[model samples]
Target chain A: MTSPAPLVVGFVAATVLALTAACLLGSTPMGVERVLAALIGSGDAGDRLVVWEIRFPRALAAFLAGSALGASGAALQGLLRNPLAEPGVLGVSATASLAATFFLYYGFVSVAAWGLPVAAIAGALAATALIAFAAVHTRSIITLILIGIGIASFAGAAMSLLMNLAPHPYALSDMINWMLGSVANRSLDDIALAAPFLLCGLVVLYGTRRGLAALTLGEEAAAGVGLNLPRQRLATVLGAGLSTGASVALAGAIGFVGIVAPHIVRPLVAHDPARSLVPSALLAGLLLVLADIGVRLIQSEQELRLGVVAALVGAPVFVWIAVRRQAARD
Target chain B: MTELIATGLTLRVGRATLVDGVSFCLRPGELVALLGPNGAGKSSLLRASLGLQKRSGGTATLGGRDSERLNPVTRARLVSYLPQIRSIAWPNVVRDVVALGRFSHGAAIGTLREADRAAVERALDACDLLHLANRRCDTLSGGELARLHCARAFAAEAPLLLADEPVGGLDPFHQFRVMDITRAFVGRGGGALVVLHDVALAARYAHRLLWMKDGRIVAHGTPDQTLTAERLAAIYGVRACVDGLRVALEGAA
Candidate 1:
C-alpha cells in the first residue's frame, strides 16, 4: 500500500517548518524580506551570521534530536518488546547525564570545550555495556527493561553526587544546563558534533527494521528464522544508545519523543515493525519542532528545558493511551 | 524423498528427561500423529524433531541431512514448526505475521520475493484467513490466532512441518479446516508430524499414530492397530472404545 496520508502531510509540515524555523531562531530575528534575502544569500553579513551561524544549527539540532529520540524509542520498544521502553528506560539518557555531569563538574579536561558531549557518549557506551552484560541471562524483554532501570537509577545517583560536589559556579551551571537541555546557544560546531552520531544511529536503526519485525515473534524464534541473536542485540543497543547519547549531547535528554512518536506511527503502519523506524523519525522531527515553536510562543523570560515541556504534554497523553491499551488488552 | 526420520532421539529439560530413545519414520505425503497424555513428551519430541530442542542422543534427519547439522537458513527452508505458546502482545496484522516465515529467503529480511508473497497469500487463503488479513492478531479469537499461525507455518512451505497441537484452540469448523490444510500439505508431497489431543482427529486425519507414555513410544502403528482399548487404557489410564465411526473415551489420566 501507499504511504499513509498523515505521513505524507507530516513530511510536508516538517519540511515547511524546518525551513521556517531555520530562518527564525537565529542569533537575531530578522523581518520576512531580510530572511528571504538571507535565504537567497543577498542579505547583510549580520543577517547571514544569524541565519547560518546560529539559527540553522538549533533548527537542525531540533530535527535530529527529535528523530534520534523517536527512533531510539521505537527500536528500544521493539528490542525489549515493551511499549513502556524509552531511551531513559534503556539507560542511555541517564548514562549521558552522568557522564556530562562528571565532565562538567569534576574533571578539567584538556578538551573541556568538547567534554560535555564526549563524556555523555562515554556514559552512554558504559550504560550500554552494563545493560548488555545484564541482559544475557534469558531472553526476556522484562529482564532488559529491569536492567535498564537499574543502570538509569545508578547513573542518576552518581549524577546527583557529582552535582553536589561540583568545583565552582561555572561547573554547577554547566551540569544544570546539560541536565535541563537547551537548543538556545547551539552553534554550527554543536550541530556538527551531534550529527555524525545521530545520523549513524538512524542508519543503524534503519538497518534493523526487518530484524525488528522478526523480533515481534520473540528472540529465539527470530533467531530460528535465521537472524543471529547476538548481532541483532548489538545493533539494537548501539542504535538506541547512540540516539540517546546524541540527544543528550546536543539537546540534553528531551523525553517523551521516544515514547510518543513510535506509539503514534506504529499503528498507522498496521503494526509493521519494519516500517516503524522512518515514520517514527519524521513524526519525532515534527513533534520537537512544534514543541520548540510552542516554547518560543509562550514567551517565558526564564528558559524552559525541552524535556520538562515534553513531560508536561506527553505524560497525560501517554497515560491515556496506555490506560486505553491496557483496557483493550483486558 | 523429503521424509523426516528420527532414531534413538532423547531430549532432556533440566533434570527431567522428556523423550528417551524415541524412534520414528514419517514419509512425505503422510501425516503422522503423535498421541500422548499431558507431559508425556509429545511437545518435546516435536521440538527435538524440529531442532528447536538439541537432542541428547542419536539424530533426527530430514531430507537425508541431520536436522541439527543443517545450516540455519537451509533448516528453515527444510522445516517449520509451531509451538503451543503463540502470541505475546504483538499488534502485527495477521498477514504480516504470516509473511515473517519468509525472513530467511528474503534479501536481508526487509524485502519479500514475488514467490514469497504468493506463498503467504496461498497459505492465508488455505487457512481461510483472507478476510482477517489486515485485522490485528490481538483482536483475533484464539481459534483465529491459531489459524494465523498455521497460515505462517504453511507460508514457510518447509518439506517437513512439526506442529504441536496445531488445532488445539480451534472451533470444530476451523479445526477441520486446519486439519484439511495440513492434509493438503502431505497430499502435495510434504511431510507433517502433528501432536494432537483429539483421538478422533488423529484417527480421521493421520495415516499413522505413535502413542507415547511416560516419555517412550508405547505403541506405533495404524489408528486401528495402535488405538485399541487396551493400549489407550495403558497409555492414558482411561477406558476407550471405537464403535463404528465413534471413538469414545472416559478420561482419567
Candidate 2:
C-alpha cells in the first residue's frame, strides 16, 4: 500500500551524493568541479588517473556488490518467509569465500587471469545447487534453511582448517584480508567480471516476486494459492546464490548489508515482500557506498574493512528490528 | 456435472495410512461438510485433493482434469482453498491479502483492474472485511483473520472451494456468518467442501454430510441420514441425542 517511488528517488539521490563524496574526499582532496571534469576525461592527468583508475572502480564495485546483496536479501527473506533470512543464509557467501580462500591458500591467484572470482562464483553456484537439490526432496522451508546453515558451517570450518595450515604468513594475511572484506584497489576488470552474474541474479530475483508474495501466507497456504513451491525454491536459491556468490567474488565477504537493507525498507513498502526488492537494493547500495567512504576517511595505519564496519552498524539494527517485532506481538 | 471427483484416494506417510481409499463427488449447488474427529485425515483429505500433499494411490479430478496434472494456476482457477492456519508472515494490509486470491487470474496485489477490483470488494463486503481493508493482518483478531482468508477465497471466485476448519475460532455470530457466506456461495451454483467439527452447525447448513473415521468415509448422505445416534456414537465415541437437524453430545460412548 505504501508507494515506493518517493523512497526510491530519495535513495538514488543519497547514493549519488555518497558516490560524489567517495570520488572527491580521497587522499588528495578535489573540488566537485574537478571530480566532474575528471569524470568527463577533461581534468588534469593526475586527477583523471586517480578518479578513473582507482576511486571510480572501487566506488562502482561497492555499489554493485551492495545492490546485489540487498536484492538477494529481500528475495531470500520473502522465499524463506523469515525476516532474518539473507543471502548468506543459504551458504552462498561462505562457500564462495571458502573457494577463494582455497585458491589464495594454494597461490593459484597468479595461475590464471581471472582465477579467484571464477572460483568464488563456481563455489557459490555449487552451494546453490546443493540447496536446490535439498529443496526438491524436502517439503518444509525450515528444513531448507537448516540445510543451508549446515552447508555454511561446513564451509566455515573448512576455511578455518585452510587458514590454520597456511604455508606462509603472507598467504595467511591475504586470506584474512579477503575474509575481512574491502573494496580497496578494485579494478574495472573486477567490476566487469562480476557484473553479468550480478545482473542475472537480480533479474532472477525480480521474477520471483509473485511466488514470494504468495509465501507470505505461509508455505501450505502459499501452495494452496497455486504457487509451484519447488520451482520458486529453485529460482530463489539460484538467484541468491548468483548474486551473493558474485558479491563474495567481487569484495570478499561483506556481511549484514543484505539483511539490514531489506529490513530497513520493509516498513516503507508496508511489508510487501515483492515491493521491498528495489528499494532494499538502493538503500543497501547507498549504505555500502557510505561505509566505503568511512573506510577511506579513517586515519588508521591499517585501513578498516568494509565487512567490519557493516557488521558494526548492521548487527545492532538487526537486534532492534527483532526486539520491536517481539514487542509488537506482545 | 461434478466440480470435483475423488476415486479411491489413498495417502501414506512412511507406512502409516493417513487417508485410505476414500472417494466422493462434489457437485455444483451442493454444500458438503466433511465431519470427523481429529487425526481422521480431514485436513489431509483437503490437502491431498488439491495436490498439496502427494497421494499414494488415487485420483482427484477438478473440472474434469486430474488435479495433480493440472497447472497450478489452472487448478487454482477451478478451486480456491482456505487453510486452517491463519498466521501471516508479514503485516500486509487486509485489502492486499485478499487480493492474493486473484493471483491465479494473473493479478497481483497493489495492482488490479476494474473487474478484479470488483471481485475483491465483493468478497470483502461479503466477509464484513471492507471496514478493515486498510488494517494490517497482524493487528487483526482471530475472528477477523478468519474472515480475511474467507474473503480471499471468495475473491478468487473459483467454482469449487476446499475450506479447512473455516469457523474454528470465531464467535457464534461470526460462525453463522461464515456458514452463511459458504451457503451463499453454494447458492450461486458453486460447490464447496467444508471441514467442520460442530455437528449441529454442519447439520444445519450442509445439504450432504461426509462421515470420516480412520481415513475412510464410513457414511455419507443427506443430513438426516448421516446424523443418526448410532453413527454419532461410532464416529465420535460419544452418546448423542439427535433430533431433526440438532445433535447434542450427551456423554462419552
Candidate 3:
C-alpha cells in the first residue's frame, strides 16, 4: 500500500477547490447570474451594487482575516510549543477584542464609519506587545499562555466596565455586535485597514520560519543552532497579533479558525511545524471562506451572524480535538 | 585547527551560580566528554560557550574572535548544538525537521539553496534515516527520534558539535550507533563536545575527559590521566576497579 501523504494531498487539494467554488457562489440568493454577471461586469445596476458594494468586500475580509488567524495560530502553537494555544486562548484575540470594544465605546477614530476596526487593530498590537514581553524573556509556552490569560481577564473587566457605562443604544448595539462578531455591511475600507498589517505580520512570520524550526529542538538547542530567541518571540507575537487584531476588528471575535487551521494543516504537512505555517494560512483562509459561505447558504430571514455558525462548528470541533488528544495521551 | 577557549567563565542563574570559574579549551577533531551527574553545571557551561546563558565573568573565544561577535547565523554556522530533551509541539516530518538545520544557510524559507539540500541529504544518509526521512517525527520511537535529532544536528554542518546527553535514553545498540556516528562526525574535520553520564561510555568513546564535581572541574586530561581510580572514588563516591576483562563501578554502573 502507498503512504498516507498522497491521501492527505488529495484532501487538501479538494478543500482548496471547494473553497474557490464557495467564494464564487458565496454571494448567491441575491441571484446566481447576478454574481456571474457581476464578475463579467454586465450585471443590472441593483445586482451589481449588491454584489460589488456589499458581499464581495465582506467575503475578502473574512477570507484574509481567517487566513491570518490560521497562519498565526500555527506559528504560536509552534513557538509556544503547545497544541492548545490559540489567539483566543492566548488572549491575543481578547486583546484585539478589547481594542475593538474601546474603539466602539470611545469612538477612537472619530469617524462616521470604518474607524472602529482600525482602533481595534491598534489594540491588538498593544496587547501583543505585553504578552510578548513575558514570552520573549523565557521560552516557556505555559508562561506565555498564562500571561495571555491574565491579559484577557484584564481586558474582559475593561470590556465589562465599558459596557456598563455605554452612553447610548448605538454604543451598546455596536459593542454587542462586535462582541458577537459579524462581517455584515463591511466596506472596502475595512478590508484596506486590516490587510497591510496582516501582510506585514505574515512577512515577519515567514522570516522566522527557520528560527521556529530550530526551536523544535527546544529553546536551548534552538539557541545552540544560532537562533535569536528574543527576535523569534517578537515576530511570533507581533505577527500573530497584528493579523488576529485586523481580522477580529473586521469580523468580530471568530473563534476556532486559529486552532482549526493549524490543526488541519499540520497533519497535512506530516507535522512539520515550519512548513505548517504556509499550509495553515491557506487552510485557514479556506475554512473561514467556506464557513462564511455556509452562513450565506443557510441564510435565514432573521440574519444568523457568522460567529454563531463558527461557534456551532468551531466549539464542538475544538472539544472533539481535545477529547481525541487526551485519548491519544491515555 | 580551530580552537575554543573558555577562561575563568562564571555562569550564574538567578541567585545560584551554575558554573563558577570554569576554564577549558577544545581543539579541532578532539572528542572531549564533560562528565557530571544531573544538576551539575555541564549543561550551563556548554550554554555559556554558545551564548545561550549570560556568563557572570570571563570570556569565551572561538577561532581567535570574541565568540559573541559572531551573529546568530554565523554562530549557527560555527557550532551545532543538541539538547537532552526537546518538546515537539507540531507533527513536523523528520525530513523537514532535518532540513530546518539549513535555515540559517538558506536564502529564505521556501528557497533551499543547493548546499542546504545537499546537507540535509548527507545528514539523513549519515544517521541511517533515509528510509524514515518522510515519516513524522512524533511517530518515531524514542531511539528513532534521537537518531533524527542527530541527523538534524549533523545537517547543521558546524565545526564544533555540542550535545547534552545525546544518547541518554537509547538502548545499548542505539547508544553505540550514536557514539559511532558522533565519532565519525569528529573524524570529518570537526570536534565534538559531549556531556555524558555513563562512565563506561565516556571511557569507550571520549579522547579527553573533563571531570566536574559540584560546580568546578575536578580534573581535565586524557582519559588515562583523568579517570584514575582515586579520582572516580572522590567525585562519584564509588570505587572503580577494572580486573582483566571485567569492569566495576561499585555497582554504580
How well does each candidate superpose onto the true structure, as a TM-score? 0.89, 0.95, 0.90
RMSD of 3: 3.5
TM-score attained by model 2: 0.95
What lDDT does each candidate get? Answer: 0.77, 0.86, 0.76
- Judge candidate 1 against the unseen true structure and give its global Cα lDDT, from 0 to 1: 0.77
Residue range A219-330, candidate 1, lDDT tens digits: 6566556566678889988887776787788888676778888888877777766777788888887788777766666766787777778878777766776688679868
DockQ of 3: 0.51
Per-model DockQ against the true two-chain complex: 0.41, 0.70, 0.51
Candidate 2's residue-wise lDDT over A1-330, tens digit each? 387889899999999888877898788878999999998899799999999989988998899889988998898889767776665766777888999889877778788847777788788889877876876577566687788789889988998898899888988887776777788989999888888888898899999998888888877777777888888888887888788888888888887788899988998888989889999999988999999999888989989999889889887876787688679768
Cα deviation of B252, candidate 1, in Å: 2.0
lDDT for each residue of candidate 3 in A56-148, tens digit (9 for 90 to 100): 777777778777888788887778776667787677777688887886676656674556655666777777777667665866666776787
Model 2 DockQ reads 0.70
Give the candidate number with the greatest lDDT. 2
Q: Identify the candidate with maximal DockQ.
A: 2
Candidate 3 chain A least-lDDT 10 residues: A1-10
- For candidate 2, write residues B120-190 as lDDT tens digits: 99999988898999998988887888889999888988888889999997898889989998999999888
